[model samples]
Target: MSSVKERFLRYVQVETTSCEANECCPSTPGQKVLGEMLVKEMQAMGVSGARMDEHGYVYGFIPAKGKTDAPAIGLIAHMDTSDAVPGKTVPQVIEHYDGGVIRLKNGVEISGFSFLESLKGQDLIVTSGDSVLGADDKAGVAEIMTLCEKMLAPDAPDHGKICVAFTPDEEIGRGADLFDIPGFGAEFAYTVDGGALGELEYECFNAASCKVTVKGVNIHPGSAKNQMINASLVAMEFAGMLPPWERPEHTEGYEGFYHLMEMSGNEEAAELKYILRDHDIRKLDARKQMMNTACEVLNKKYGDGTVLVELRDSYRNMKEIVEQHPEILERAKAAFLANGVEPIVKAIRGGTDGAQLSFRGLPCPNLSTGGYNFHGRKELVPVQAMEKMTEVLVTLVSVK
Candidate 1:
């Protein structure tokens, strides 16, 4: 059996950082590389239908060894890391953490006082201080891979048909765009992309991305009193009109907010990009309407058509879908208990591939990858947590 640490270290070294601006499916060639690698690895594990599709999605099936009548369960994980940072990672292993601050060579510190207290006494795998650790879903990938290898053994317990998919561009929120759901033939699926151990999530925020463009007329300073309209200032005004306390930095646990992701402008024109999120659908709609109202008020003050706001729905909460099939959560909880880990059921403040997959009729839920502080230089994951997650996967599949 391949250790999860070895598998994760090897996979994260592949550098599969997805691109949000890319028009293609996988978003990066590195995704294709990882997909092809997964295909080969799956085929070696005796999984049938192991193929990397034209769009760089790696999928395969492990036939039922004993009971062929059981419902087929899907195990999924993404191949790409977040585009927030580079993914050319060199993982650092800290064996037996002594409950103090861990200083990364890149001049960052993971202080024991700041959430690191929970991970004390565990072996951690972190980045080399320059890039993300890629454990966001790569840890998921390694866990799924290890579980498949175990199930393929001759003495393994009986299981239903198990389907596995390694999707690309999840970091860019396009993980499910090219997913072959019907072809996958699984009644339900689980995405191994959550943080920490024993995290089983079905609720996620209703997400939307907005682009606000402000147009202004520039004039010479001598005649700038009433003739000039500064676009940057107007953009700032529009942002300030939103509730100041409602933001990612100030809110937590079901408190939705409008996050201004990027803002750039000059006197002529300025653009502000934002991501709006709320777990409650009603509040989500209200948040969008708030954006419209802000635009309306700004336009009223500076003539019509001065502000243009574009809103696009990204994903929705999966709670309604997963609640209908309570057995999935129950089975996961049982599996976690059997593995000596208490399940932490919570609502994800952000989105996951499972959220999109659930709406696509797969009824998928998110599972933990034991990773912490993802998408930056401080990303880390516990080796023991990864091993237990793999065990949880095996237990879930083995259960009738």
Candidate 2:
């Protein structure tokens, strides 16, 4: 059996960074490359019907061996890494970590995070400080693949039908957009894409994308007195209208925030992209209202067509949907406890593919891949955590 660490190392070397600029499914060609690789790997592991769809989604199933009556369960993870950093990573494996300041290439140091102290004596896969480690969902992919390999063994315990899927463009928030729920053929599913060990989540933020465009007249500084309306300054003013403390860096838990993701412009026209998130639908609406009010306030001062705001709903909190089926959460908690890992039930401060899948009638919840500091240069995953999660999935899918 191939270890999860080995599988993860092999998978992360493929550059699968999803681009938001691309409108097509998968977002990047590298995603399709990874999907093809996963499909081949699944087929080699004796997975039935292993294939990659045109949209770069890889799907396969393992039929019940001993227990044919149990409900079919699906395991999902995204194949693409975040576009925030480069995806072509050089992973460094640290054997028996001493729990100190570990330095990487390019003067990047992994320290100050309290979670590191708990990982002492365990092996870890970290980045070389040049690119993201791609552990966000690839670690989940590796664990799921390992689970399939184990469950398909001749001496393996009895399990229900196991359906596995690897999606693309999850980093761009389109992972569940093209999902084939009915064709997936699972009563319920779990997205193995959370952070830290034993982190299980059902609730996520109600998300929306906000774009503010400022149109202003630009004139030479020598001749400009009152005629020159700086669009960049107007954009800054619009940003300032938002609560200073309400941001991703400031808030935690259920608290919502408006995160300004991108801003670019000169004097004639400026654009600011923000993501609004809140667990409460009512609060999320209020945040949208606040943005509209800000636009109105700015337009009333400048002109009618000076400021324009566009708001689009992204995903909703999955708590209401997942709570309807308590057995899902109960069964997951049991699986975690069976593996001697204490389950940490918490609301995700950010959204996941499971949030959208739950509303699509899958009742999907998020599971931990034991990776931390994702989407950046310092991302790392513990070898022990991945092994334990593989065991958890085995117990999760096995029939009594």
Q: What are the per-residue Cα lDDT tens digits for candidate 1 across 308-337?
A: 999999999999899999999998899999
Per residue, candidate 2 scores C-alpha lDDT tens digits across 147-264 of: 9999999989998899999999988899999998888889999999999989999999999999999999999989989899999999999999999899889999889999999999
Candidate that scores best on TM-score: 2
Determine the backbone clash count of candidate 2.
Answer: 0
In candidate 2, which residue ranges exceed 4 Å CA deviation? none
Q: Which candidate number would show the highest lDDT if scored against the true structure?
A: 2
Q: Looking at candidate 1, what is the lDDT of residue 233?
A: 96
Give each model a TM-score.
Answer: 0.98, 0.99
lDDT of 2 at 225: 94
Candidate 1: regions farther than 4 A off: 112-114
